[model samples]
Structure formats: structure tokens, C-alpha cells
Target: NTTAAAVAMLRDIPVHMSYSIAVIDRQGNYATVYVNPDRPAEVVERRVSTNHQHGVEWAWHAETTKSVEREAAVEKLLLASASIKDVLSGFQRPPAYQIQYGHDCGTLYTAVYRPLDASVELVWPGSLWRQSCADFQDEVRTIRFNDGGSGGLAPTFKEGAVSS
Candidate 1:
């Protein structure tokens, strides 16, 4: 069912495009669909993608150096059973994290999802959002970014309950 849904979604996009999408459900069911322009979709369980065509030879497409680095780091983290916090930190690593104010495409936020609980935590430069299926409240938890222009520094996560 997951695979079918993923394929349907992929087909919805106009053809002749290289893309990847992660589809997940609260029951721990998930699928990542990869498609190269003019090619069929393939479902991959363990993969790292950053705006490039996957499931193909590296020489066939242009995968940025930073994307490669981040993918490798994620593979290592997945092997080590890293927590969501650690994964998010890895994403903030050099060349991967971006905060260009004037750029059209820069890192705006990072998200951590625990499908079993249907909980998601979204982290931005100055705030965080945490919610679960049980509690539908919408709130933004402000946090401090101590990077000082340096990348890869994890935001100073706050303790205690979220404030209103």
C-alpha cells in the first residue's frame, strides 16, 4: 500500500524530472520513491537525497559535493542508531547548512518525526515547534542559536515544558 501510494504521488508530478520523496505513516510504514526523468520509480529504504536524481550512477547526474557529504554522514549516523537530534545536528554540518539571508533557497528549518507517536519537532534558527497526534495545540518554542556565524552548532535546546 505504501509503495502504491508513493508511486501514485510520483506519477502526479510532471514527467521528465529527477526527484525523490519520502512517504511515511504513523504505523512505522514508510517508503522513499526515487525517479529519474523518463525512468520508472524505485523504492529505497535507506537513502539520502538532496535535490538530485537518485538510484542511478553518479556520473549520470550532478550531485553536489555537499549533498554527497551529507549523504555519507547520514549513512554513518543511521548505522550508529543516532537519535533524531543527532541527525538534525548532522544536517547542520558545514557545506550542508546554509543561512544566506538573500538567497532564494537556504536552510529555513529542520524537522524530526517520530511516526509511532505521530509527533513532529520542527527547528528553525530562533524557534521550535513540537506537537503530537494526542495534543493538537499549535505553538512555537523559541530557542537560542549560538552559532555566531559558524555552522554545525546545535541550537541550545530548552528544558522543561513548552511555554504558551
Candidate 2:
């Protein structure tokens, strides 16, 4: 969600611009993304776990509850914060926004994008956070979630390609 929006800003494009984004889990196992409704002509190569085409469908499951809770928490934080940094900072727990579900699932990293400066801040699994700036056109930034350590770097990708 926020990451996708940040990516849109980084690319200097409208959020509804026709593009497909994929987000893989920490283990590089599972992945998900919200399909772009504005671009019905675009084809998604992967299966989308949660669909945002119509509206949020709350199925009976713990995973769904966690997802809904995180969405609500992020919305509340977004409204209260004065800046993107504030919003990112607020994500550090008491509310426990970071997920760590042993071997099954967990949050690998958190990121914040500052479109005005073309900069992004990445928070790794060990609570280590770093910031970097780049030319969104020629170079793209990415975060890799691994089983041990997680990190990010700005890599050269084909123009208009989305990384998650």
C-alpha cells in the first residue's frame, strides 16, 4: 500500500498509472499486490492474495484480522503525523506493527518514500534504518528480505519497471 504509493511518487507518476507491482515475503516465498483498476488492459503475472478492485473483503482468518488492523493503524498514524518521517517513526511498536511469525510469516522491512527529494528510508529487520536518494529514472531502489539479514540498494532496472 504505502510502499506502492511511495514507488509511484518515486517514479514521478500518478498512483493510478498503469503498472503492476509485486511484493514477496521475507523468505522470498509468498508475495502480493493490489491490482491497478484504472488499467484493466494490464495483465498481472502473479496471483494477488488480497484484491482491492472493489473493496476490502474481510474473510474469517487471523491473517485477515492482522492485515485489517495494520491498515487501520497506518491510516490513523498517517492522519496524525506531520511528516513522512514521523509516520515511519510511529511504526516502531507498542502497537506492534512489525510482524514476526516464526517460520511461517513475518515483517522483513519497512520503508518510507519522500517523493519531493526522491529519497527513501528503509528499516531492516534488526531495527536498523537507512536513507538514500537516487535519480528515479535511471536508477531504482529496492529492498531484499532474506532469512538472516535484510537490506536495500538502488539498482538499474528497465524504465517503468516496478520493484517490491
Candidate 3:
């Protein structure tokens, strides 16, 4: 049931890569995907991957707390969006994104809240789904850099590099 919930969630989300959802448990655990025998059956908290751990445990907590705060702000904007003017007020503002869950497998739930300056919308559905989430920040950064530069960041790595 968890597997199905996970898969369903992944399927529901708008993403490019073909993926399967895997629910991670409380003890930093997630069931294995049988599709890849070589891959581990479990992914623990941060056994998954992250750019950097907080300098301290509390630091991480502080960040999580900040995220929850940001989440609340985003939700508030969505709830208060009664007019297009309200939506366009922050039209160019970046969105605050987050994913949260309770338990896994049975009635699993994963949500992606994208609250831009525009009208905020949320997709809270059963399943853990994300694609290129981490890279999105980098993508934004790239735009900023390129916009500031005369031209743009050149593509250093060629797609054909691996063909030979």
C-alpha cells in the first residue's frame, strides 16, 4: 500500500524524469525499490543527500523552523489571495518551496507549496514527489548571474562527451 501510495504521488506530480516514490520512515528510513537490486533498499535521513548539514543540530532545527515559518507565510498568501492585484503585488518574488509528510505507505502524503508573488497554489497529494528541487535554487542563481553578465554562462560540459 505504501509503495502504491508513493508511486501514485510521483505519478501525480509534474516532473520530467520517470521516477518512483519511496516513503522514508521516522528513523530516517525508507523501503527499498526492488527495481534496482544494486541500490540499497533503504535511504536514511541525510543518507539521502544534502548540500551541507547545519553547523549544529540546533542550526538545522533553526532552518527547519524558518522553513515552517516560510511555509506559514506562503499558506497565508494563498488563503488571502482574493484579488489579482494581491497576486501581482509580489509577481516577481521568488517562491518558498517545501515538502512535508506524516507517515508513509498507507495514505502517504507529500505536498509542494509554490507561493510565488503571483497567485499561490498548492499541490498536496498522497506520495512523495520532487524533481530538480535542489537545482531550482541554482537555476535562479544562474539567471541572476547571466542577467548581470553581458552574455550568459557558457555550457562547459558537452552532451556528446559520454557518447564516445
lDDT of 2: 0.44
Look at candidate 1 and tell me the lDDT of residue 49: 65
Candidate 2, after superposition: displacement of residue 93 in Å? 1.6
Q: What are the lDDT figures for the candidates, one per model?
A: 0.60, 0.44, 0.31
Clashes by residue pair, model 2: none
TM-score of 2: 0.44
TM-scores for all candidates?
0.63, 0.44, 0.25
Q: Tell me which residue pairs clash in candidate 1.
A: none
In model 2, the runs with Cα more than 4 Å from the true position are: 1-33, 36-65, 94-96, 125-164
The residue-level lDDT of candidate 2 at 110 comes to 63
Clashes of each: 0, 0, 3
What's the CA error at residue 44 for candidate 1, in Å? 2.2
Candidate 2: worst 10 consecutive residues by lDDT?
148-157
Point out the higher-scoring one by lDDT: 1 or 2.
1
- Candidate 1, residues 1-164, lDDT tens digits: the string is 35466667776576576667777775557767887677677777745566554533563233434456556666776677657667676666544564433333345567777677778887664456788889978654544333335444433434345656
lDDT of 3 by residue, 1-164 (tens): 34345544544455442222335432333442222223323322221111112222355643643434444555566578877546433221322322221111111122333322212232222112233433332211111111112122221211221111
Greater TM-score among 1 and 3 belongs to 1
Q: Residue 140 deviation, candidate 1, in Å?
A: 8.6
Preferred candidate (lDDT higher): 1 or 3: 1
User: What is the lDDT ranking, best to worst?
Assistant: 1, 2, 3
